[model samples]
Target: MNLVLIAMIAAMLIPMYEAWKDDNIWQKMLALASISSKAGIMTLFISVLRDDWMIGVVGAIILTVGNAGLMLLAHVIKRLDDL
Candidate 1:
């Protein structure tokens, strides 16, 4: 379980590095979305390991809603870029 959590944390860092290295807006947004997803998954995993329903619920919400908000923000940025 510890190894799995460590691996997940390492995986999350990849996107963070990409986001930091890239100057393009689209790439940055994609990287951020990836980070959000990984975070949610990590949270879910932690909740399951501890057998906690409240944390699980929060994880589920993050998994479902975080990306949607990011997508909406991306769309808004895209429109603004077009202006």
Candidate 2:
């Protein structure tokens, strides 16, 4: 379990690095989206390992709402860019 968490953390860092290194707005948003997804998955994995329903629910909410919010923000940014 520790090894799995370590691997997930390492995977999450890849996007963080990309977000840091890139200046493009779309790439940064994509990287942020990826990071959000990995964080939600990691949270759910920990919840399952501990057999906690509350944490699992929180993770599920993070997964859905976080991504949806990001998509909406991206759409708004796109519209603004076009104006």
User: Per-model C-alpha lDDT, please?
Assistant: 0.90, 0.91
TM-score of each: 0.92, 0.90
Candidate 2 regions exceeding 4 Å error are: none
> TM-score of model 2 relative to the true fold?
0.90
Cα error, candidate 1, residue 71 (Å) = 1.0
Candidate 1 local accuracy as lDDT? 0.90
Cα-based lDDT at residue 73, candidate 1: 94
lDDT of 1 at 78: 90
RMSD of each: 1.0, 1.2
Q: TM-score of predicted model 1?
A: 0.92
